[model samples]
Target chain A: GQQVMQIPQYQHVQEGEDFTTYCNSSTTLSNIQWYKQRPGGHPVFLIQLVKSGEVKKQKRLTFQFGEAKKNSSLHITATQTTDVGTYFCAGPVGAGSYQLTFGKGTKLSVIP
Target chain B: SAVISQKPSRDICQRGTSLTIQCQVDSQVTMMFWYRQQPGQSLTLIATANQGSEATYESGFVIDKFPISRPNLTFSTLTVSNMSPEDSSIYLCSVELAGRYEQYFGPGTRLTVT
Candidate 1:
C-alpha cells in the first residue's frame, strides 16, 4: 500500500504572507496531483507533476516534485483571502495506476 | 474537462437507513471513482467504478456495506447500507478523462446520519 503524508496540518497566515505545504510518500510515485477544496465545496483539480524534479507554476502558486519522486511541495506566494482552503497532494496507487492515494491535506486560513 | 453532477446535494438520514447517491457525467469517461471525506479530514478512496462490471473496493470497504453500480459509461450509483452515525460524511464522485492525469470531482453529496 502507498501512503502520503502532509506537513502542517493547519496553517494561519496574514493576508499578503506566504504559505507552503509539503507532502512525502512511503514509495516513489509516477506522478503527483494537487487539489484544493473550499469551505463547503468539493475538491477541485489544481495541477499535476509528472517528471522527477519538475517545477510548475500557476499564477502565484508553485509546485515542485522531488528528484526521487517520493515527495512534493506547493508554495503560495503572497497569499490572499481567496486562498483559504485545504490543499491536498495525491499520488497514484502504483506505477501506471490511475487510482490516487491522497494525503491528509493542509488547511489554510488567511486573515485579512 | 468533463461536467459532473451528483444527486441530492445534501441529505439527513436516520441510523440504520440506507441512502443511494447518484453520479452523472456529461461526457463519457473510462473510470469513475468514489471518495469519502469525514469532517475536518481529507479524502479517502472508497472504490473504483468501471462500466459493465463490479466495483473495486478499497481495503476497508466491502460490497455489502457500500454497494456500487456502474450501469453505463456516464452513470453510477453508490448505496451506503445500514449506515451509522459514523457514516456521516461527504461523498464525492470523480471521473478520469482520457489522457488526463487529473480526476475531476462532482459537487459532493453531504450525508448526515443521525
Candidate 2:
C-alpha cells in the first residue's frame, strides 16, 4: 500500500488566474493519474502521466510527473468557473496489481 | 474504461442502523476497490475486492465494520454496519484497468447518519 499527499488542501482563485496543485507519494509509483470531482458530482477521469518527467496538457490544464516518479503536479492556466473542483492524484502500485493508492486531493474554488 | 451503476445513490438513516451499497460494472474486472470520501475532504481506501477471495482491507478499516462482498467479477456490495454519524460520507466503487494507470469510479453513494 502507498500513501499520497496533496498540498494546500484548499485554493481560491479568480477567473482568468492561474492555479496549481502538487501530489507527493511516500513510496515510488509505477504511474500516476489525476482526477477531478466537482461539487456534488462523481469523480471524473482527467489525465494520466506515466513516464518520469513527463508533461501533458489539455486546453488550459497541465499535468507533470516528477523525474523520480514520487511526485506530480497539475497546473491550470487562466482558471474558469468550470475548473472549480477537488483534484486528486492517484498512484498505481505496479503492473501486477490493479489497486490505485489515492491522494487526499486539493480543493479549488474559482471565483468569477 | 468501465461504466459503473451504483444503487442507493444517497440515504439518511438513524444512528446504529446499517446501509448496503451496490456497485455493478458493465465489464468484468479482475479487481475492484471501495473508497470513502468525507465532507470537504479526500478519498480513503477501504478495501480491495477479489472475485473469489475475501477482500483485503486497509489499516483503520475492518471487515466487521465495513463488510464487503464480491460474488463475481462485475459486481460487489459494501455494508456499513451499525453506523454512526461519524460514518457520514460518500462511498465509491471502482475497477482498475490492466496495464493502465487508471480506475473508473461509480457515481458514489452519499450517506448521512443522524
Candidate 3:
C-alpha cells in the first residue's frame, strides 16, 4: 500500500500574503498531480509533474517535484480570495497504475 | 477532456436505505473510479470500475456494501447498500481517458443519511 501525507491541514492568510503546502509520499511515485476543490465544486485537475526535479508554474502558483520523486510542494505567491480552497496532491497507487492515492490536502483560506 | 455527468446531485436518505449513484461520461473511457469524501476530509478511493470485469475494491471496503456495475465503457453505477449515518458524505466519480493520466471528477453526489 502507498500513502501520501500533506502538511498544514488548515491555513489562513491575509489577501496579499503567500502560502505553501508540502506533500510527502511513503513510496516513490512515477508522477504527481495537483487538484483544487472549491467550497462546493468538485475536484479539478490543476497540474501534473512527471519529470523528477521538475518545476511548473501557472500564473501566481508554482509546483515543484523533488529530485527523488518522493515529495512535492505547491507555493502560491500573493494569494487572493479566489485561492481559498483545498489543494490535494496525488500519485498513482503504483507504477503504471491509474488509481491515485491522495494526500489529506491543505485547506487554504485567503482573507480579503 | 471528457464531459462527466452524475445523477441526483444531492440526496437525503434514511438509515438502512440504499442509494444508487450513476456516472456517465460523454466519451468512452477505460478507467473509472469512485471516491468518498467526508466533510472537510480528503478523497478516499472506494473502488475502480473497469468495463467488462469486476471492480477492485480498496481495503476496508467490501462489494456487498458498495456494489458497482460497469455495464458499458461509458456508464457505471454504484449502490450504497444498507447505509447508515456514517455513510453521509459526498460521493464522486472520476474518469481517466485513454492516454491521459489526469482524472476528471464529476460534480459529486452529496448524501446525508439520518
Candidate 4:
C-alpha cells in the first residue's frame, strides 16, 4: 500500500504572498498527480508528474517531482483569493491497479 | 478531462437506511473509481468500479457494504447498504479517460446518516 502526506495541514496568508506545500510518500510511485478541490466542489485534475525530478508549471502554480519518486511539491506565487482551496497530491501505484493514494491535503486560505 | 455528473447531491437519511449514488460520464471511459471523504478529511479509496464485472474493494471497504454497479463504460452506481451515522460523508465517482491518463471526478453525493 502507498500513502501520501502533505505538510501545513492549514495555512492562512495575505493575498499576493507565496505558499508552498510538500508531499512525502510511504512507498515508491510510478507517477504522481495533483488535484484541487474548491469549497463545496469535487476534486479537479491539476497536473501529473511521471518522470524523476520532473517540473511543470501552469501560470502561477509550479509543481516538482522528486528524483527518488518518493516525494513531490506544489508552490503558488503571489497567491490570489481564487487560490483558496485544498490541494491534494496523489500517487498511482504499479501496473493494473490504477489506484491512486491521495494526501490529506493542504488547506490554504488567502486573506485580503 | 471528461465531464461527470452525480445524483442526489445531498441527502439526510436515517440510521440503517441506504443510499445509491449514480455517476454518469459524458464520454466513454476505461476506468471508473469510487472514493469517500469524511468531514474535513482526505479522500479514501472505496473501490474500482469495473465495467461488466464486480468492483474491487479497498482494505476497509467491502462489496456487501458498498456495492457498485458499472453496467457500461460511461455509467456507474454505488449503493451504500445499511447505512449508519459513521457512513455520513461525501461519496465521489471518478473516471480515468482512455489515452489521456487523467482522471476527472463527479460532483459527488453528500450523505448524512443520522
Clashing pairs in 4: none
Q: DockQ of each candidate's interface versus the true one?
A: 0.90, 0.71, 0.95, 0.85
2 or 4: which has the higher TM-score?
4
lDDT of 2 by residue, A10-44 (tens): 99999999999999998877788899999998788
Q: Which sections of candidate 2 miss by over 4 Å?
A: A93-97
Q: Which numbered prediction scores highest in DockQ against the true structure?
A: 3
Off by over 4 Å in 4: none
Q: Choose 3 or 4, whichever is better by lDDT.
A: 3
Runs off by more than 4 Å, candidate 1? none
| Candidate 3: tens digits of C-alpha lDDT, residues B1-114 | 889999889999999999999999999999999999998999999999999999999998999999999999999999999999999999999999886789999999999999
Evaluate model 3: give its TM-score.
Answer: 0.98
- lDDT string for model 4 (A11-103, tens) is 899999999999999887778899999999889999998899999999999999999988999999999999999999988755434788889
- Give TM-scores for every candidate, taking all chains together and pairing residue i with residue i: 0.98, 0.93, 0.98, 0.97
- The digit string of per-residue lDDT tens for model 4 on B6-46 reads 99899999999888999999988878999999978899989
Q: What value does DockQ give for candidate 1?
A: 0.90
Give the least accurate 10-residue stretch of model 3 chain B, judged by summed lDDT: B94-103
lDDT of 3 at A42: 92
Total clashing residue pairs per candidate? Answer: 0, 0, 0, 0
B76: Cα error in model 4, Å:
0.5
RMSD of 2: 1.7
Worst 10 residues of 3 chain A by lDDT: A92-101
